[model samples]
Target: MVGDEGRLVGGRYRLVALIGQGGMGRVWRGVDETLNRQVAVKEVLLPDGLPPGDRAQLVRRTLREAEVAAKLGHPGIITVHDVVRDADVPWIVMEYVSGPSLAGLVAQEGRLPWRRVAAIGAQMADALAHAHAAGVVHRDLKPDNVLVQDRRTIITDFGIARVLDGSAGTRLTRTGAVVGTPQFMPPEQIEGGDAAASGDLWSLGATLYAAVEGNVPFDAPSLMPLFHAILAKPLPPPRHAGELGPLLEELLAKDPGKRPTAAALAVRLTALHHPPTLRDPQPPAPPRQIHQRSTVTAPAQPPNAVHPPTRPAASARRRPSTSAAPGGPSRRTLLLAGATVAIGATGGWWAWKSDTKDDAIRAGTSLPGHTKNVYALAYSPNGKSLASASEDNTVRLWNVTAPDGDAEPAELTGLFWALAFSPDGRTLAGGGADGTIHLWNAADRRLVGTLKGHKEQVSSLAFSPDGKTLASGGLDASLRLWSPADRKLLARLDGHDSNVAAVAFGPDGKTLASGSWDNSVRLWSVAGRKSVARFSHANYVSSVAFGPDGGTLASGCWDNSVNLWSVTGREKTATLDGHTSVVRAVAFSPDGRTLASAAEDETVRLWDPVEQNGIAVLSDHSGALCSLAFSPDGKTLASADKAVRLWDLDRQLPAP
Candidate 1:
């Protein structure tokens, strides 16, 4: 049975400090008074409100699982000392190993040298080999579960994950319920099939993938897509692990029968290099600052993928031909991130003077509802709706073509700061001053869900072109990615030194650009889960946008300047300097021929990016423009001040 801190258990063991927690329960650093030595104690947490019968069954299962783990004897496996109970709950005592986890080590060093990763993998594989022979599978293998003590690897929490093994007639979990982290879970586990010895190898591959690449191989943005990727998508080929790509592929084979045996894996891993010699362990190092790229030599050619030769041809398709979710592009239109589409190579913005027959933008529609300043505006992907947020704690959805032209606003407890539409246009998301994002059904204007994590006001929201990921920037100086479908937070990106003002997805959906009040604009490789480049600005960067082709990036800043950049070269290309006040928002026209920026000077300036000169200025608003967006057709532009204004571009073009 478990005891609180400082409480004596089993008449001798005294609980001290909690060292770790997981699905199983909590692991505490304790002392065995009889032996005068420190030990690790796992307190099995029983769920409350369970029926007495089920509670008794769970207790029995916990002891049985602990017995299975206690039988294994290997240096790479943590040694079990004893199992006891105080009040019906079981506490398992284990030999304490003082060191940091492999995950902790990777967090400190970015990524270890390939040679070092191989040595650690070899020791882990050998340990798994011993357990498999003993009929005990470490079903939940991950970087956080593996500890490095005195240069030797120790795999912990074995045989405890499946306390209520379904095969043993236990029903603790519902049928087909997944039990581990999806990033490392194999297809079999996702399918709810029994986890086998080969499943451990797959998770091991994923761990090694993180150790070398600094991210997961699949890393889907949400629940449905993540499950789909594990079941359908081929594993992304490694980029920095030279000569080890094939091994990773073999270990990650979709079919268990196709994977290499643990013995074979051990041979290959040991052949890479000898393990490091034991030394006096120093204090654990601080977690590695993430986003720092490793120094490993990148491959001259794209990393080669090694698919199984016997897999069915049907399994090789990128994505199924199911009809797209509402407002989503066709499956064929979804491009692979690996395909290199050249950005702004030679077509510097072309000059096309407007003819006498051409029309310029003319302000037409005005919508006033907010009692205070409007802070953000966005046009739905289908161009049929507009959403606006304001300091008055409300987000209003507008049916642009409604005969009455008025829609009920969604009220929030906190002031609204940012707004965005999902790629499919069925959902609208708003970021509030409370640091939470609220999602609404655009078609019905009903509340969908709320995502909460950040501690400061959320400042901006952007959806990937594929409609799979949502990126939100906050005044807390952090950026987070979410899956709009199920509201799953995919990743939390931290690097901005000050408030993040804006976020936008590249046309391909593989790259994301974020502008921050820190006076910097950062480019992130979404697939790689790391910031690839950073561009400096003279003052606080307030807004960012990507060109129609994803080749050029634009940023508007408080310095009253708007700058264009080449996404390929990561260098500034041109600067437009006509605004006299803070440039608040920027948007690229659908045709990529013109750029639009809003400013606190109460004007929206159209610029020719290549000429680096202003094309025209629309000064129809009396108040500062806080946000702007171009309709999907590019013929209409929407801007927000204290009120929202719609301008018809085709009717207001300047004549030649």
Candidate 2:
């Protein structure tokens, strides 16, 4: 249309030329008058042949969800500058890449060389790792989403699959609104699972399978047959996968649980692309320094990767043995923390310390069930039950009383980032991406009511000690108080400039402390709904929790470190660092004697909060660690990914 060319969108963006158009959306190379920069604008055009219903709302929300991609900062990933809706059409502003899409490149060049495929796959893995660590699942991972800018590979259009699926699993199959490409969709996805990050790894494998073999692992002329082939049929062996074949096969496993997690995929890809020739066990950081921050630079792997191997089994250089893990699970090198922080752990306790020491926690057993990433874990007040929430949009209610007993899956309307139990254990609260708090009857797991107020996904939730008032913080940067009794909003507390990632009620329930992406934790007076004080974090804070005594508060951050603050002093008492990845969840043991922390490193560390020294590192998970909770008796520490792990603290021994 003549009106489209040279048209202004969101006031300042002038669409100069159409770069491309597809079933998903249209890409336009445009100019930003305000920023004085050239930009690529993606006008998300809903595909044709859909049920005749209003999808405009879906577009807007999906665009907002894409904002979560802005948090993905890896160089291999395209930068999402802004997402806006103009005239009911959503436009995403991103860094303009001059290179062709992987799909375009592969189409024009037929089949890629094994080395080329390895190189591209490695970069793609790195990008995916970053997304996974940030808790953003690139629901759609395919050749078209990969952009090759010279030697650099970048992934784009994140949050699309998540936003597209909109509804809970399997229903997409009924509505024919499935999230990803047919050939690239994982079995879990075809069957109607929500945005499971493991499914992305599967898609990555298929994308690589197509890049080298010149065809996807599975295909059919129609959608039903294609899904059937994906489900019942096995992945055809690759003809040109070269050394990458084994990894590809692993990624395409029929079982999602059997796949390499977000962190492992990147490490495996990098290890294959750059095979270690040195006799040394440690693979010298790849010739390029870019692959160091993520687990072996895999891009900060997933939160529940069966094991974030920390290093390529064949890579060069050995990090100092976290004295605790000399013969145990591998731990990456520790980064120096900001200030007043220490790293490592020893006898018993959970805390991320920076120093390399003999103290470390031992590995624990995995409780299996969920097929996707677990984002939040919470123990019921009475401690008999545990709740784990995942992107799969289901919360697994584990019977902690038996610890080995079967779990009951509680269906959710949407994905929740945080879970909290009522003080009396009569109700369970789920904070979800849809920005609603779903309350369920504790015993039967039946939905009782939905509390709404936050503008974006609820990132964290907390119930007062008295169980009268509930506090919530979200990506909308809004902190809200609600009375579950009446399902009404009591007040909205506003101060944070970015996503409020965590909320916690003080021991007395008189104060609420919230952590945010703005790099600060604000303490508010619960009843007054007024900001009482502010504590600065070394980096974007992901979690905040109060000690049993309420005299101290712990804040976990993206900086791969944890800071404990003295509640009275409102100042940092100690900084602990040990994990190589972002610290996602921090919890206090029932007695508050042991402070536990989980990070992207896939290890849960115990810290002696009183001594401010390292206790022990618990290594058992695969991808990044998101949430941690302690059983009422403090004998068990719970963390989630695909399976919820219950660390038997009493049986746990210091690493050799």
Candidate 3:
């Protein structure tokens, strides 16, 4: 038993008020004298008859929880303040969050709006991303652990599941003892297997299902039956009361791999409520028909199709022949048989190709080519030329459209670090490590002039929609605007405290967005050359771009994530987390229907901007991929690493 007092057990923490009580422990809003802050102290009284070894294991589990939670820090995660021993009892001090749990909200309101569920789910996904990155998995993720307050959703008790990470000997119950709450345990977890990140995903699915439908998908009288049902039964889709049918079906898929991750699921939920807003009025291109051809070899057949003579009518059996024909069959018979075989093979090959001709795209078509990592890639507005720059100090221009349609790439080179093409498709501008900006004629591939003024290596380059001004940022922590025609520096804007990694001109060309290594993105007035607003981030910003409508700005960062923000800088619209390494670039499609992101993981991922799900991943690169671009026609996407790759969006897979 514990009491509210200045001293509890041995004066580890002064208890103020009881926050929550669970089956295993009591949480109190307390004051930690050493840390000088209010903290949530969780106290678990040891069972009176507990084995000595089990008590030791519990102590070990408590200590491990402290170690794990201390390493993780994210807005969506509850902070662990400290851990202390009070006589025989152990307690964990966590940041005191004054918020209502999702369970409390559901209990009070009965159900939540789909959009609010999506918003909360997205924040939980971000928290999971952080925990997973730190090699910690939350085995018990429930509505009770989700704190929602002040328009923010936070995931609490991040490391309490360390108890489940214990060795088999440390487990107190039998082999199939009940662990997680039965209603939310995935099929695999119910079979006495260890819980993994996938299990948490299933729990999230169950939680969301409950939130949307106001009931649990599976309910039973006891834990054992619930476990049996989870392991042996298929989850029924949510009741058809409204529009949650499709979303529930996807969430409860039997195979964890088939189920979408939280990040992907959030996007689907978003699309359900807020359909995509198309920027351009043009419709998508008509589907393309692909032609396929093949050649096959045929095996020769015997000229005589007659069956071998059987044993004489079960009476007199004839002996087998002692010797056969010299080459087993006559040459004329072989030639005739071969000709027949060839005819049959030709017919089959033709039929096969004709049947599957509509699908001809091959895997691994994209190839990487730079000596060092590729930093940027862009396709000309006409969609005939592709340009890429790399850390190896070289830029290569590949004729995207070959005259013969099958001709290999033709490379045009310069020592460049970033590349972008003008809106009119007449010129290509490249920023270089040599502190020079080179312009080239897009059609003839002729070098024009170098704009020289920057005193440090350029990191990013972008052109305005009208193609009047080019924005460049570099290691000198300054942004320079240049006039492409005259190759003259228009203005150098300086305010960033660290190197600028990315710069973009807004759709209206009135503002410029620049992201820097100092973990901030600043909106600047292009004409006035002054900062308007600064958006702070937890990690270094790697890339920045404006959405098609120019109302939202998207930034990719070293936090292994991407975020969308409103132009007014009021709130974050969404946070996308899937890349396993640093995200280097983010690009929205011309139609704004898709988003392309390149990361240090050596792959370019295609995301449905409205849906938020990653639809395709191009992974031919063997080195870090640093840039992404889409063709103006929206039929092709280009990704760059050491080499550049062009993916044909028009290509389709064959029907099974």
Candidate 4:
């Protein structure tokens, strides 16, 4: 029996409409008037097999699900809005996602194309990457747990997952509850070994195989046979997986160690070409080899005819003649003396060929700029001067030549973490750990004024393209929009539960993006003073930058990956993975041809943003690289570590 609509759930959430029913619970689409938002309310129906006391345990388990889901905040991960009890029934309020499940897609489309499959796989991988970074493991992963809208994918049903290092009381399974989907479970998972990130990878492979092949790799008419096949038989390669190439082999590897990491797989999948075919056939052997004897022999030719000389004979004939007097002219010497005759016979063939020097330059180099670990960097609209913010607490202005040459850098002081130049390169904004935003004349290294309002450390700062509004995020968990001219705070946007780490203005300046340690990135309307979208990540989002086209937003996270989201916030176009540690900063090259990421791994990586492949790694830094900036001319890149280093974009290799 279900409760009436007037009944209040969890003392807060108001039940509205029944949305779905599952084996373990009933779900309702409810409204959280307190938050002024819609949330999915799931009510667990206690199993009849459980005793009165055991029923309490079941309720406790349901509560734990909410606790676990709440910790995993990621765009690709379904958000858990709230958790509470309604009339003694445990309920969880999650972000309401109006999207079709992956199971529905399979039923409707039969099979998805490789590109879509790859795209989905990449998203899932990124979700897992964030979860793993936060020490969480999604024990159960399957098609039904994945949601798709506008062809964008998000992983849901984190009910059975557990946060790594989280308290044991939060674990839901009752010792032998059969936690994962049978078809998708990895061998180690079935054996009850602690599921690691690799288990999720294995499941991703199974899910991807089913999506592209229209059938599970291990399948049968009945459960027993399917179980046997999954445990015994090898998975069949996807028939329609044309140019998936190395990705196919990597995804299906039996040994988890042999499989590519999520970051590596994302890069490989990005290069996949559809409608691929098998390798080319071997060419036929020459006819002369078919008639040859077992023993090898040189072919014979007439003396007057042009013939290829045998190596041994030519060397022997060219050796100094012992028969000739010491230092006297031999047959070879006589041939050299008659070089003019030989040259005439050869028709001057050798004179036409000449060796040429290689002219192509490498990609990714540190450009001249700041003097310390750069915390912020951005290219001006016209892509001329590059501005950098550093731990040295100074903003540096750099002059870059159009083609490529020497770079001259000018410095200003303060331990700044973020820097942005006006669209017209007339003004510069620098934010620091001291909770102040300073404006500067871009043309000269003079301070214009300091804008102050934040009560804590300022982590990020951004300026509207119109240069009228500036947005800043800080440890106060608030976003402030400022009037640069009057140094007045226009609006204080507050919602995040933790420190706000990043902020950016959309191309039109109508929207602003702010990322925080709360593991959420919120999209706000500059005029309406309202949030338009909320994106979650499993870990703190460290940085966000809009692409040159303004159609996409790229976010870097402590998860060590970057995600590209469409403007509508309906889809994640790609997940770029390469950093081995927390990604502290991310920026696009002036032309958007390359994406530069600085990481705690002490390495700055340059990636092909569109292709999602890492093009180069700048490994000279011995400390964490906190920020990166590209010159307006697109020829130089400035990275910050203990000391700022300038990288020549045209130089691909590392410094000696």
Candidate 5:
């Protein structure tokens, strides 16, 4: 039986609902509150009336299973976040893969295409190869243990799998108690033989057979007959296998040694999925091919880290998760998570496309257009275009990088409060006061779509560094992530007490910072789709920004102060004081060396992040500065007051 939905186990994992129930244990959809991420928790249930000694032994085995799973670092395998021992029982916490199991999908759709199955087989074989390389062999491999999402296949339930490392290998079966499913077990395994890597391959073959045929290759109504069929019965030919027939036959070969190695099987399956395209037989040189292959395989060499966004480190090595101490600083918490990819997997302050001439930007050069107070401003990823949203019910785009005087900005009518450009600079998203988000094709400036979900007014919007997700915060007190490509709501994040005013994605695209009128600044894991940490503010948080290095987060508050936080320790390292009134906007230069903030006092202040002191103040704006943005190249700054104005940081800030 599963525990109560709200039960908190081990002071970290919170059980929300039972997602899966099996004879061995129960799986619950849960949350890791400290990290504010959703995770799957599997609670191993000791059979009723079991002897105390047996229960202890089972606990040890379960823990060992989790340890083996944790050692596996592959994109195709589910990541183990933590293993908790509660009430003398072990609970395994793992990444929550949101996808249907192969068994479920096959059952729903009545079999799958052989090409699709082959592709999935390739991924699974790769993951299993990784496990075998770690000296761990999964005793039970079946369609039910694999999850499928798009082109991604994730293998789960390692908790029920066996580890074949050293002395542990001797405990394959205690007193002849059989393990593994009958239909998927290899012939040697059915005869009570040790589980080997080849046995897993046999299981994989059986799974593929079922996937394409919608039925197990070998099934019997009784255990004795099932064992007989697995050990002595000839392999059942698959009708729907098509091109996969030869591979499937090789996998189900009775002689384990005759079966293809996991790596070799992956190559063959991948070939079937995508047959070789005719090309020059010589192809590229060996040296160039090696270089290219190295780049691709580097990300999966380590266990998936929760913070794959941490550049260089994610590529160099996999680090253990250093969970924050209760009531202690949460610095390094982001890095502690296993990264899913290498350096390019995520970026810092992201890559900005810039073509602007640093010398062309000048201080106090106003780009006037908005008929009312400009509330938001943003520089396109290329730094060639500038977008401004205002209370005048309009959003305008400017070709700021043009060599000649502005040919005039393109104007779109909408009651907007916040504006952001997709990382590719192809889409312009504007948060409307009418509680909707409007997306425009940047090339033709045509209204492409509208995202409606927020009930109150939408105040802030931002795109993930990858541009795959669009995040918006609104007066509804909720932050929503949308797939701009499909105009579909992906997830809704709720926590703020009042309105959310600002949203920004860190350069790595993993951490998201949002400011709220609730007087709080919250950091979220965009991948995990949950709030990670919160920074308290003295007053309403008006705006938020992240340094390009991803090491620092800044928030402007209504109390006329801007706080610089060290993401490493969740500590406020600096309190920048100079604005006489409320600070409306805060931004960091592309290089992350300088911090910029705008206030209603008609000034934009530049600060030396290293010194934690104000560097210079731009006071030429004729009205209150409501928003601020730095061009991609870090050479220019754009501020919004009654209209948008440019400042050339390259010509340099005013002398302090």
Candidate 6:
């Protein structure tokens, strides 16, 4: 029985009405008996066939997730208050948000204007940046998880995705539990890599695309063909998306590393929102291939030469708006001679043409902002800014809106190993060789605070999803959690046998993973302060990251291999071997479909981790690379070595 009216859950939440229902759970509008306040309760219905151990694991994971989700303090994010066990199932008590979901709005209103969609998308991206900064990844970010209140978008169901990840074997799916709605899911999610922050961004992009285009990027009736389409099919250009088409194409890239980051996407979306420009209701012209032999010349216009008005293209006549603004077609008087030549010229009267332009890399695209070797690079949450840390003891923030120019740079006393921005983009955190982590005001480049707890050089730093806690791993083989707000050490996680090189928190902030020179990756329960599982690597592990779904962990090692592990069993699932030198960084694309590995071999390779097959290899860097990062949308990949090499994945990678 789901959401039975009048039934009380955990002797507190009394069901008043059933609000929604899905394959795994049902939501109810209820009243908290103890607090006398309205609340939304999600009841998870576990499949009866689950074994005792699996059931227990799912329950434990849910409880842990609920606790972490309660900490996410963001206006755009839904609030989870409690997790209670009732009638052998878990009931998640969430703040009752009063509004219809974005999906519902789309269904009722049809396709939204691009401007409206952009505004909504920008807000969604801002929420995601907040959740990510707090170390929380909303694995199932779909239209249903997004609620519109007072014209503002709010993301709900903050961190309850673990139930599906744990039950993927039997109970969680009519098909397979893909960590999200299949229509909006990235190819990575279907391919079996855990969804990462990038995954959430991908789903958000898909949602925005659907809002404006009236359907998902990939629409199929069944699972098998839909999976194929998501993996192999080219993204059909959005007919109604117009200016948003390019952004959607980048977001829907089969390669996760090619997608834009949430910050970058937010910036783009905000730019689209200020003034709405709806595309004229007409199909776009297909790209016509032209021969290289065709002559293309600039029209003559000497010192004071004046030209007469020209007629519109033949096909463009169907939609007059194509030649003019919404007001109406321009009524300029034209000279017949000039008008005749404008519509007809080369190829024996075939429309005037030019050779097909190659979409290849050109000179001056790369930004050379650092003097010495660049060690780290991070995009601000809103995506308008970029911060690059160099070996020259300087952290430079670049206004990426104009990548060619440099903004003011911040001078640090020591070389920094890690750099991360707060969710709001107001604060910056930098970990240094001096065994201390420094915080700075992003706006003014002013020093704010310094956290000191590590006895050795800090190797990595991550801010929790709520931006309240900062986690740092050091060469001393310990992970310390600090409260940046209080300037106090919260807890010290000691389990690694050797120097800790990397640290990453799961989307829900329940698990903190650390990689060490001891050749192991250890997962620790954040609240319990204990190591939950240990995964072994052949050599020293250099980087560790939890997939967006928080079910899988990817680690890069000195043995020139990247390994994927199941977080539940703590077992190695696959070893990706291709790089000739030590693998320094490993990242799962936002959707979890593509795994990107960077190494000292001077190349970065994208792999289908589930299939254990290599995809594309990025070899644009000039020297051995030290780090690699995917933009939130996965459309662009940034690799740092002697300098930062930004690969436009859409144009750089071969067609599927």
Once fitted onto the true fold, the runs of candidate 4 whose alpha carbons sit more than 4 angstroms away are 1-7, 45-47, 51-58, 159-179, 245-249, 271-656
Model 4 C-alpha lDDT per residue in residues 1-656, reported as the tens digit of each score: 25656456767787888877765567788888788788888776654455666567667766876687689877788888777876676777788889888878999989888877887887777677556545567766878788898746888767544421122432324343434467887766555466677777788888888888887777677656766776677778679866553466566666767665554344235323121212236355333221111110111111312212212211111111011234542221112211111111111111111113221211222344344445666666676566666655556665443333234455577666677776667888887655778888877767889988865557788889788888988765678999888889899997875567788898789988888877778888889999888876767788888877877778887666667677774456666554556677888876787677887766676655555544445555556667777766666566666555555454332221
Off by over 4 Å in 6: 1-3, 168-179, 276-656
* Candidate 5 lDDT, 1-656, residue by residue in tens: 44488999999999999988764578899999999999999887654555787667767877888887887767788999888899998888999988999999998999999988998998898687667656768777898889998779999876465632112323434334444567898888767577788999999999999999899988999878988888788888899999799789999999998887675466347445642222225434333110011110111111323212212112122122111235532211112111111222111111111223343444345676676678888888888888888766777887786542262455698668789999899999988866789999988888999999986567799999889999999865689999999999999988886568899988898899899867799998887888889988766688999988898888888666777787767767766666656688999888787788887666777666665655455655546667898889888788876767776556333233
Q: On a 0 to 1 TM-score scale, where does candidate 5 land against the true structure?
A: 0.46
Clashes of 5: 13
TM-score, every prediction:
0.45, 0.53, 0.49, 0.44, 0.46, 0.45
What TM value does model 1 have? 0.45
lDDT tens per residue, model 2, 1-656: 43699999999899999988766688999999899999999988665454435465576567777788877766778898888889877888998999999999989999898878888987787577557656788877889999998879998888876776653223354345454578888888777666587889899889989999998889888878888988998778898888788888999998988886644455345435532212225445433121112221101122324213232122222222122434443333443331121233232322222223322221244567777778888888787778888866677887755524457665554667788999999999998765789999989888999998865578789999999999998766688999999999999998986668899999898999999877899999987889989987656788998999999999887666777787887677776656666788899987887788887666777766776656665554556567788888877678875667765555332343
Q: Which structure is stronger by lDDT: 1 or 6? A: 1
Clashing pairs in 1: 1-85, 1-86, 107-288, 108-288, 359-652, 359-653, 360-652, 360-653, 361-652
Alpha carbon RMSD to native, model 2: 13.1
Candidate 1 lDDT by residue in tens digits, 1-656:
23478988889889998888876678889999999999998887776566788888888877888888998877788999988987788989999989999899989889877778887888788688668756788878899989998669999988876564443443324444445567888788777678888889999998988898888888767777987887899989898776577788988889988775554465357545332222236455334221111111100111113211112123121211111235542211111221111111111211222233323322335676766557888888887778887756677777776643465555443467788888788888888665789888888777889999866567889989889999999766689999888889999997885668899999999999999867899999898889999988776798999998898999987666777788998787766665656688999888887788987766777766655555455555656678898989887788877777776565333332
Report the C-alpha displacement of residue 567, candidate 1, in angstroms. 0.5
lDDT of every model, 2 decimals: 0.73, 0.73, 0.65, 0.64, 0.73, 0.69
Q: Which stretches of candidate 3 lie over 4 Å from their true place?
A: 1-5, 9-12, 45-48, 164-177, 240-247, 262-382, 385-656
Task: List all candidate RMSDs to the true structure.
Answer: 23.9, 13.1, 24.1, 21.4, 24.0, 22.7
lDDT of 3 by residue, 1-656 (tens): 34554555345578888878865578888887765778888876444455788877777777677668877876778887777777666677778888899889899998887656765776676567457545677877888888998767888777675474344353324454444466877776666566776677788878877876778878889877876676677887666324546556666676766665443343234324321222225444333221211111121221212222212222222222111235552221122211111122111110111222232222223443456556678787787667776655566666556522232343456556678899998898887765678888877777888888765567789999899999998755678999998888899888875558899988999999999867889999987889998877767788998888888788887665667777864456666655556678898877786677887666566555554444444544555666888778766677766556555554322221
Better of 3 and 6 by lDDT: 6
User: Candidate 4: lDDT of 636?
Assistant: 59
> Whose TM-score is greatest here?
2
- Indicate the worst ten consecutive residues by lDDT in candidate 4: 345-354
Per-residue lDDT value at 224 in model 1: 70
Candidate 6 per-residue lDDT over residues 414-473, each given as its tens digit: 578788887677999998765789998888878899999875567788777778778898
